[model samples]
Target: MKKILFIDRDGTLIQEPDKEIPQVDSLEEMVFLPWVISSLNMFIKKWYKLIIVTNQDWLWTELNPRENYTNINNKMFEIFAWEGVTFSHIFECPHFESDNCKCRKPKVWILWDFLSENDIDYKNSYMVWDRDTDSEFAKNIWVWFYKVIYWDDKHNWWNILEFVAG
Candidate 1:
């Protein structure tokens, strides 16, 4: 079975700057956390295509309104491009919690979609999420789960990947 590692964007791979969820509508606020690059590459080296699945209802709406997540893709890619890092795939849920959408975390829609679109072997895939909601999504989807944490000791992506992947 082919394996894929699905990761969360904020608070996990990227440290939550400003003590809050990133309002990364623009590249000016886009910041890469320590070891994020190395951590991802390690999984890739292990034959796991890197994927990121996240929920950002705050993007399109405030006070529980779903916002357009359309801008996020380019912003994220630009950050990676500036840093020379790349990911294979990404999926997101833009609905607010009040929307109670099935596609959001703990719902498994993103994972299911990824599996169907990529023809991935579900049994061999894993997900890394920082919060329980995201983990729940991976669980509901029947994918293995890992917690993505940040350690100040992580200074670069190589070190981060070597430590996490091991």
Candidate 2:
């Protein structure tokens, strides 16, 4: 079987833009982008593992980092419970952009780690996100298997969800 798909939550699946997005440990702050519910539902039926890959610079910069993490986690559980979307994993990069860590997207370490742990097939796996940085990150790590899908109408990012579901 092909490996499961990895996804980005902010902007791509939801609209919590980089600046406004909290730690994302909670559901209230984790709002979905338009068509996210339906689009992801389709992928579920296709038997793909819908994992959410995110960058959480908020945790590192929050006024009270530990408390911020606590609140965010509560919100995330609540929101997911309501939305009925169970993620295989929620990998986050809590470091600032300057941290220059390899776990960040475009870097393959995390996804590669996920695949290694689960024995997933990279050849059959794919990634979807809505930001230039994320696209660049996934591409840097996964290379040809990564695809950037436009969330709305712009071609600036290609919509791999549409292509795969169709």
Candidate 3:
């Protein structure tokens, strides 16, 4: 069975833009969080399959153009590749909160196919994210949850490394 690390993109892997609805609209707005690359490298070295699970609201809509999203996403992948950190899969929900889509975070509908196909070690697997919905998602999937407080100076995102080390 494979131990997977389900990660969130915005605010967790990258610094979320401070807006009413925080989203990385363009390449210029994309900024990776501190210690993200190194911590991900550690996870990869520990033999964890990295999976990105994120909610991208208004995607492909006029509000959030698909081309813009693709450009920004591709750049993020390129940077991660340069750092030797690669994601096994990326799952995104492009529905708004009002849509109440089954694929949204806290719902496992989008992951059902992957869950059925893979021999996952849920006991050792973890969900690392930055929101309450993400915590609920971990509970919904019956996996360990690690909440990342991006602005916490004391942690500075080092707790994840410590957790993985232990």
**Each candidate's lDDT (Cα)?**
0.66, 0.61, 0.88
Q: Which residue pairs show collisions in model 3?
A: none
Across 1-166, the per-residue lDDT of candidate 2 in tens digits comes to: 5456677765566555345444344445566555556556666777777777887664655442767665665665566557665677888776666889877776667667656667655565667765677767656645234434434463212245566555
Per-residue lDDT tens digits for candidate 3, residues 103-147, read 999899999999999999999998999888899999988889888
Give the least accurate 10-residue stretch of model 3, judged by summed lDDT.
Answer: 153-162
Off by over 4 Å in 3: 154-156
Using TM-score as the measure, which candidate wins?
Answer: 3
**What digit string (tens of lDDT, one per residue) describes model 1 on residues 1-166?**
6677777887766555563554455445556666676556566667878777877765556532333234545666776656655788777777778988877777776566556766666676777766778767777767777665556354344544544455
For candidate 2, the lDDT comes to 0.61
Task: Give candidate 2's error at residue 8 in angstroms.
Answer: 1.2
lDDT of 1 at 141: 67
Q: Which RMSD values do the candidates have, in order? A: 3.7, 3.9, 1.2
- TM-score of each model, in listed order: 0.73, 0.72, 0.95
